[model samples]
Target: MCAMKYGLLFFVTLMATNLVSEADGDLMSMIDYRYFRCVMKREWKCPDSEINFFMYTPEHPRKHFIDPRYPKLLHDFGWDPMRKNVLIIHGFNGTYSKSPMTFIRDAYLSRKDYNVFMVDWSELTRFPCYLSALSNMKKAAQCTAQLYSAITQAGALAKMITCVGHSLGAHICGMISNHLTEKQYKIVGLDPGRPLVSAYGSRQFRLGRDDAHVVHVLHTNAGFLGESGLVGHADFCFNGGQKQPGCKGHIMRIARCSHFMSSCYFAASVRRSRRLVGIPCDTSCPKERGYWGINPQRRAVVLGDDVPDGSRGMFCISFENTEDCPFD
Candidate 1:
């Protein structure tokens, strides 16, 4: 059994490394050597030590590490109970500092309206350890839930908070509800990881429509790195949700770019709400121009941060070219 376990580990590592090679060049440049050391050291069992909560507010733009164990520290760090809170979680092979997830963090900070808290569990979800990262997700979620409780105990309302996550982090956002007495008010899942998650993950372990009061999912690489079909109350598929027009090069590279684009699109939405709009379409992207016109009766739905809480069903948005889409 031990030999089989090690062999499986070797296989997963090899496969993940090959997969990472196909990612966008920009994503490749962001890989921190520390993640390699963490993966090599087999730091998969995410204890309390592996998870951290860093709070950022307009008053204190710099990150202030807040321990979930000390809920009162929130007050000490200039956390304003009056402002809405947003918890941002990064995905596999991601660090709070370098990953594309930082786009969303900065967008929220620029608005100066939210008390932003970024959950950094990079040590637990390092690269080339996809299986281990998946294993660590529940512990990470449980730890994040403590932070949620800490924020609430510090006088923030649960209804005024939003949980935003990318890829595996998206599922972590959903799983956070498992440890809480009540569900979160909102959750925006950016291209929730597909791999083992879509095929094997249970509802409790994956992002689902019922995970939050309003769950919005942006699919930029569906059927590949991102989850396909209707996975949330509001699902937006950009450029057919397969290959983003803005991405060029090999198919895998495009897929990676597309996967990362989910966060980019979302961040843009936060900065300019209601700017990106989608029309009601089938589960997939509309085939022709006539298809888009066929649904004149259905009102076009806004995508991204300003998506109406009541919006439901699959929506599709097509861009004439890369310039038309906000994929920065």
Candidate 2:
């Protein structure tokens, strides 16, 4: 009987393994199609703690590197102190080399003579270790805050600096903004990562609404990678902040689709002049189901790079699968 039971168990395990292996290709292709080139490799080794900054300007619109050690490196990089500065922070398991990060930098460089900085902390954010990456986020935020201070002390205006962070990177921006005394430096959090941040409610570690002068959060994958609760001055939920339009198939793709849409919409907003129309709702309203309401008296506002000053409160936004111009 023992021999028979052992053989049966081995057979069951083999079958399960074979099934998973067979479906692996389909799952990966679906994920790639919806995520727009995501690398889901398992990186077990701990990455080094290093932050890289890629700067881009109108004069040298291509791309340039800046050392955080030398605060005056901006001058050598030909940074324009007059133009607005945008610092983009990528999420867990992501680097500045990723399409979203580069796309954002290019979009800003193409639109105006703004100084776009890409913050790469991939060393500490390797894949399959999201918990480790979440813990290291505080360190990343500390490094970023130091860099921000150094840059301001050298020449750049603190008010002109706008930090844009996606997923876990968004929370890092919030932590950085919290440490900075300058209240005018806005933070645009693109679907701040939900899992670990919400699990630990300690205010010292999580991103709050008043972390910056104006904390604007865009929730595209709430309850998944994004925190469902409103954690910003203005929280905009796109497509009810759950399953997005473009993503279908596997469960993983569904979760990632909306989470990534936050960055996609923000990137598109940089080059496109047309803004999205958002409908306002009561504070007690459910954000995930915000689209099925009727409140015409409330004025609609843009939710991205073109958002006007003093656009406060929560709102619901809808967009087409391809772009933000077309509303649902």
Candidate 3:
């Protein structure tokens, strides 16, 4: 088991190191990595991760999964068609019960009367074998699309549905949006994973700006787990999207803590409480000017899942490392 795990890790390590190797002054193409990917794909055969959806409402705070096949399951569960729906997708090794996921879910439920559903695919996204989990994201997204389809057919409004994903789960939501012919109301990517994904430009595998009618990305750990590229209509970076506040000591601890802050900041944003403010810009702002500076006039977009539309391009907001309040 150790050998198998390390073997997979070796391939990932090699590809990551040589992400942009040069041959005769020419950038070596992705074909070089394809061989190892093929081997992993064929040998592993990609796990068909089951996508589970749990719905929550103010009346009944307990999370429950409603089967779309029954159509009436949602109605029976006290789902209000009038209320807008938001589906939450968790990242690698995450589940419905986890911190960021549950925190974000409860935060939304605490303030709004919207239908909140948490999408769990933790079985396939177990830790240590991220390669397998990354490949399985597509299958999981397809399953989610089918599930969403069923739900919408059952009287849920597709036009009113908003899907939010954190880490690799963000990419999964992107894939789900890509798979469906109809664009979802909105897709919010909270720090989309960078490793094994940042190198690729394929719209099929990675999230893109056009995946949904309105795609917003919050980069709390950008250039690390979060892709640094501007891949959304509005990409908001809090504290430059790395080395987040309250994450101190040790490299790994800092990275992990900062990476997860995207969700925490987002959860707080839903209630519009002490939200990090961003200023709109016709063109992208210089890195030094935004996020790092505490200019209220420069505020672009409020940090969270509920950003109002109108502005485009990247935005930034600053906060101290010890400050729990986003902009304070």
Best of the candidates, TM-score: 1
Model 2 weakest lDDT span, ten residues long: 15-24
lDDT of each: 0.78, 0.69, 0.69
Q: How close is candidate 3 to the true structure, as a TM-score?
A: 0.80
**Candidate numbers, best TM-score first, in rank order:** 1, 3, 2
Query: 161 in model 2: Cα distance from truth in Å?
Result: 0.6
* Predicted structure 3: clash tally: 7
Candidate 2 residue-wise lDDT, 1-328, digit = tens = 9999977754542332222121223423332332322232243222223766778888887678776677787888888777888889998767887656676777788877588888888876654335556667777777787768767876778767888898888888888865567653688888887765677646757667767767888888887668785788777877777777876657765666667777877777777754766677544223535344545676787766667657766778776676432111
User: Which candidate leads the pack in lDDT?
Assistant: 1
Which stretches in model 2 have alpha-carbon errors above 4 Å? 1-49, 284-294, 323-328
Distance from true location, Cα of 70 in model 3, Å: 2.2
Per-model C-alpha RMSD: 4.3, 7.8, 8.1
- What lDDT score goes with residue 82 in model 2? 78
Put down candidate 1 lDDT per residue, 262-303, tens digits, no spaces: 888888788874378888777553234345232555677777
Candidate 3's C-alpha runs over 4 A off are 1-49, 281-299, 304-306, 321-328
Question: Candidate 1: which pairs clash?
Answer: none
